[model samples]
Target chain A: MLTKRIIPCLDIDKGRVVKGVNFINIKDAGDPTELAEFYNSEVADELVFLDITATHEGRKTLIDVVKKVSSVVFIPLTVGGGIRTINDMRIMLEAGADKVSLNSSAIKNSAIITDCSKEFGAQCVVSAIDVKKEGDDWIVYTHGGRNKTNINALEWVKNVEELGAGEILLTSMDKDGSNNGYDNELLEKVNNIVNIPVIASGGAGSLKHLYEALKFGKADAILAASICHFGILSIKEVKNYLIKNKINIRL
Target chain B: MPDISILNTKSANFHSVKKAIDLYNKQNIITSDINEINNSKGLIIPGVSSTDTVMQNIKDLNLEKIILDFYSSGKPILCICVGMQILFENSEEGVKPGLGIIEGSVKKIPKLKNKFKVPHMGWNQLELVKESEIFKGISTNTNFYFVHSYFCDPLDEEIIIGKTNYSIQMCAAIQKNNLLAVQFHPEKSGKDGLKIYENFNKMIS
Candidate 1:
């Protein structure tokens, strides 16, 4: 059976982990490698390192962070932020990233999806779409949910799949940082459109929310950030909850 | 430790494979040179591209003969994903001929009614059918990471040692005498994945 994944996402800034990671066990909660190792030890199915620092120098350091984390963590590693070209994707992949997530750059130039997928198989490309609800229709937002695109969320999901994206990282801007639950309605709608795996992100306040995302939303994976980072939920706890709920999970 | 040559067809993440094996303290190299591969105790054809591209790359690197030679020489050979698919006669995804070491044809996984995805990405369990050195320390039904759109269909089912299900029972791992291959990437499979490399090293020395 193919198990659903519980991924711990780390927001990296200037090559260091940020975004309210307050783990008492980790001496340096700011370190990317240590946080990655902690998550790996807790049995995180995968890890995503998003470079919040969009500066040129930050890009160079993110590569270093990816190399260090991949050296220690054996699971799949995905790096995003400031990935503008196929060459940028190559640099991260060469640094040992398994997949490169495309967010702002992907929306700025949708052709990068086709080009990256062609150069490095479709499985290596992850399209991250941030969306906001607007009168029953979801709007695609870029620049970390700051700028809105004219693309409809469902239409964009279908177009992304046709453009050769292997996976979709769908985030609900309203649900994100809200501590409510994943937007299962949006997730289910996107899941219905794309045959490829959809990773449900934003608004995972508890284990039940994760369950609902997989059960009601049918998302292939759940991207847990605040819950795991704040120690409210661990990756193992999420997997355990899913297993108890009759979900096929890697425990 | 004997040298392990990860044959670089100029495709796939052999570096990740090299990293995994390095944890086992194995001497390995990622190279396309025929001599380096022939001299190594084991050869790993790590693949992550279309069959046509990998096959063409093998020919370009002049590794087609080298790979066939190593297979018959009784040296351990590990083929990954597309690497495993290319061992068959041919594939539906690509037109180029495979190495034909294993009598099989690669076919695309059918799209089920919203139940299963095409790439079959993410973690999936392994159903061991027969004992093989590659899975010496691995458990049955243990999840391993996989990302591929097609599956292998061997003419002789007896060669299949590992099986997995997405929508159908597809061959996940295979072994024939001294040759071994897996549809999943052990290097990307965490602890159990590293164990696969450790077991592969055991096959070497």
Candidate 2:
């Protein structure tokens, strides 16, 4: 049986990890390679590096970071942010990324998902959807959640899967960085519609929150940023909690 | 000196395999050169991409004959994911005939009442059915990373070594003489994954 994956998401800016990682072993918190090595040692099931700096130079820096991290870390590494073209996906995959997550770019051009999936296989393409709850419906947000599109989140997810996306990374913008919990309602709705694996992101405060996301939200994986970056919980600690709760997690 | 040669299929990810080999202080040469691959003691065909494109590239580069020659030579050859799929006769994912080195056809993982997802993504525990050198030092139920839509169904079940349950019990690893192939990607499977490479290295040595 496949185990639930616990992934640590690192926000990268100009090639450096942006968050203040409180791990004692890490000397340079800004260095993605160091944080990656630390997470690998801590038994993180997977690592995600999102380049918040969406620039040409920033993309180059992210590639260099990916190359360095891939050399040290053995587990799967997913690089996202600023990935607009098939060439961009190629650059990251060739640099050592197992998968590339498409957010704003995918929304702008749904055809890119099909093109990327054809070129690098659907398993290599991940459609990242940022959704915000509006009155009765979930609305899709783009450009780092600054601009809202009329696209309905539920409908978009189904379309993306048909477009050949292997997986969906659903983030609840309202719950993002709030540390309350994940939008299990939103997750449950999306997970029910898509056949591919759903990774629940945003609003992860404690281990219990992660567990709820997986157990209640029916998410195949949990992508946490603040909880891990601030050292509130280590990957092992989270895994242990999930295991004790009878959730099948990778240790 | 590198004892293992990883084929650069142009579609598959070779860096991960190289990194896995490097972790054990072993050297590996990534090349599509027929002579280099044939000369190596062991060869690994890493995973990723569709089988049609991979096979087309293999035939285009004329590596098919060399691969057959290597297989017939009885030297250890490890094929991963799509690499493993191409070892069979053919697949539903593509129209191209496989290497036909192994007697089986690649079939899509059956959907199980919405309980199982396609691509069989993420880490899953291995259920060892038969003993094989590739699984040495690895315990049963050890989790390994897997990302594939189709699974291999061998005509000769005797060659089956490992099985994993996603929605159904499918062949995870198969060994036929010196040719060993897995539906999972060990290079991305963490510590246990490295152990697989280490074990394969030991076999070659």
Could you list the CA RMSD of all candidates, in the order they appear?
A: 1.2, 1.3
Error of 1 at B200 (Å): 0.9
What's the TM-score of every candidate structure?
0.98, 0.97
Q: In candidate 2, how many Å is residue B63 off?
A: 1.5
Predicted candidate 2 versus true structure: per-residue lDDT over B1-205, tens digit per residue: 4688999888898988888887764668989887788778999998689999999989888889888989899889999999999999999999999999889899999998988889899999999899898998888989999999999999999999999998889999999999999888998987788888888888888
User: Against the true structure, what is model 2's DockQ?
Assistant: 0.85
Off by over 4 Å in 2: B25-27
Candidate 2 pairs with clashing backbones: none
CAPRI tier of model 1: high
Candidate 1 residue lDDT tens string, B1-205:
3389988888788878888888876578888876778889988889997889899888887888898899999999999999999999989998899999999899899888767888999899999999987898888999899999999999999999999998999999999889999999999999999998899888888
